[model samples]
Target chain A: MNDSTQTAVQHRDYAGAKLGMWLFLFTEILLFGGLFLVYSVYRSMYPEDFHEAAAGLSVVLGTVNTVILLTSSLTMALAISALQRGNTRQSVLLQGATIVLGLVFLVNKYFEWSGHIHEGIFPNAPELLARSHGQVQFYGLYYVMTGLHGLHVVAGLALIGIMLSLTIRQRITREDNGKLENAGLYWHLVDLIWIYLFPLFYLIT
Target chain B: MNEQDNHIVTTKTFAAVWIALLMLTAITVSVAKMHLGAFSAFTAIAIASAKAGLVLWYFMHLKYEKRLLKFLLLVPILTLAVIIGLTFVDVWYR
Candidate 1:
């Protein structure tokens, strides 16, 4: 191959890379979308039981977690902004903050789940089964949906953690920060899912 | 597209969006406290949709992305809506 053509082949396509990321994100949305459909069907079938079961969830805790995830999103966005502006130090700090916030969110989720299990409120538990069919369905969807979302949070944290190290090592610099931007996109998508999950599961009381 | 990547959103814009999101959360919570009966779910979903929109447009930088990307995103979204709408119709009529 000619020298000029070889250099062209090595060039990074930032927008193409991001478009690919968005495609993956679209599938992620539909993955959760299926669970949402199940939740909607059951809730419509038994609105009262759904409402009753949802009340068992602490809106206070849910609200706190929501705020935590949202703030992490802000930090993640700023991290990208910082990197684009050539402030590597500030970008690294913001990325670190985002990771910490994600961990804190998981910690809060741990406590919330433990509290529910202590109450014997998990799926297929005797207490949950004893409730109406709709309530049973409600808790089933609750565990699956939130559990899946929590897993995504973990994944997003890992991605951001990698991006953080990359920033510190100068691997993700102003000129080639597509990786960091993609990570930020994934993090924001995680936050977006919770925005819907919060009200659907917690606030429909 | 490379030039678009150079666009640096100000920290002030990020903070403004953050505050707006927090306010929406508060409003949703307060509205939930009221006994709106069947309208409760509708109101909650509406507010949540608004919040989701904000996150997508700003945090995800969809607003800054090309119009073609936005149109591509609508594909999956519209599919979901159709699926939900058809299923609900069946259930409601039955």
Candidate 2:
């Protein structure tokens, strides 16, 4: 078949598109998985310092953020369902809620990080540097992992924003809701990573 | 498209999963406060894994996906397990 003919035939294969997204998500999983491996190795090596450092973190704040993310995931799922059911207005409202929830999570993160920084607890702060090597590693990993996760949250917001616009424009209809579904998948992956991160960083100690 | 392929998860199911996850979070946090030694870590991770499973299966629609897609999802996780296990060997010996 000619190239143009083949392209036309391959268009609108929702399963194929979803498969491509899943493959991309696998790469993302591996990316974070490598970091988790490093975390485990370090935790094993400096068990005491890791525990002590983790104890300084605010479990209340962590739990609150966890709830926020979980709620956002629910809204995201509902948004996709709304889109699939041809309820564009409701879908947009749910998407807005998800985005607002995501922002709230980020705001809480900001305050949390600032609190740590104010207390000289940042990765490279003089206070942190003066701490034991294990403490230093603990803070370093904490910042890096959570920072990366924050970036994912920002990216998810942008993607959802685009989906919102697409929905408004009727580009993403009930029959062509794959993009919205894919966006939900990405958002869930972000939430999924945090599920592991919350326990690893905050609770395990 | 097949009806099953386009299955829509109910809001009730999502709410139930959210409640279960929150309850698990509370349990893990309470478990953390008790000095359970190594078991504390195990319990926390186990709870987190359950929460993640619910999110993956329900929120991410992996349960509604085709069998092949579901298997494909496991490939990366299995690969990571092997990688982590090998790394542990080095850490254990040293």
Candidate 3:
């Protein structure tokens, strides 16, 4: 059942492109999957503590990032469409739009994390001296999962920037834009991770 | 995935997607302030899932893609579902 877009394709870079993307995606899933497994086990182990710790996160920041990510996904879709129609310029613009939005997301995330730390909500030292003191590990997990994902966003932005440069130079054309398309796939995977993360990290009871 | 099918989209499609994303953002944020019991989580996830599907069908071109790729997507999801089931089986007992 490994029949992703990869499809053992040989003789052309299309197969390689899709296959490379799928492999990258698998690695991403594994990365986040490990986190999810940890979270699930810990959540079930200390449900009350996790809830209290989770309540400390800012829903407003999470919501903003979610919107930023959703808009990025939309632009990415349009970029692929532009590429399909041989409109490399428009495609590049759309890709650029996605990159800017991603940067904005990361900037917002930086401020959010800093705010949390300023409040002494660090996993090592939470400020509120309540029964929720033991929930520091949950904060620890939150930082780790979202931090890894933030790194992915930064990487995705870099990939898109390179792709935009390639497109501008007319190197990526309608026939062989597979690399750009696959790059878009990488961005989508980042978006998908947040989709699950938003609910898992922010919406927990 | 259209592959010589000329299933190219118009700027109008992108515009529509922008509008949808804005609406989804608004709704997702507005829902956060509501108290809907367990359904609060479900509502947020439902919206997120819809957003994913929209990206896949339009952005990923799954709608115009070959059947092979379509089925390929299900493999990973199916596998994940099975894994989740197994995890719950173990966790529920412990």
Write model 1 residue lDDT over B1-94, tens digit each, in one string.
3654466889999999999999999999999999798898899999989999999998899888889999999999999999999999999998
- Using lDDT as the yardstick, the better of models 2 and 3 is 2
Model 2 steric clash pairs: none
lDDT of 2 by residue, A1-205 (tens): 2333433332476788899999999999999999999999999999999999999899999999999999999999999888777788999999999999999999999999999999999867899999999999999999999999999999999999999899889988887788999999999999999999998999855
Candidate 3 residue spans exceeding 4 A from truth: A1-11, A126-134, B1-6
Task: Supply DockQ values for each candidate.
Answer: 0.65, 0.57, 0.35
Tell me the deviation in Å of residue A201 in model 1: 0.7
Docking class of 1: medium
lDDT (CA) per prediction: 0.92, 0.91, 0.77
Q: Clashing residue pairs, candidate 1?
A: none
Could you tell me how far off, in angstroms, the CA of residue A72 lies in candidate 2 after the best superposition?
0.3
10 residues in a row with least lDDT, candidate 1 chain A: A1-10
What 10-residue stretch in candidate 1 chain B is worst by lDDT? Answer: B1-10
RMSD values, in order shown: 2.5, 3.4, 5.3
True contacts kept of each: 0.81, 0.70, 0.38
Residue A23 C-alpha lDDT in model 1? 96
TM-score (0 to 1) of chain B for each candidate? 0.93, 0.92, 0.85
Error of 3 at A142 (Å): 1.1
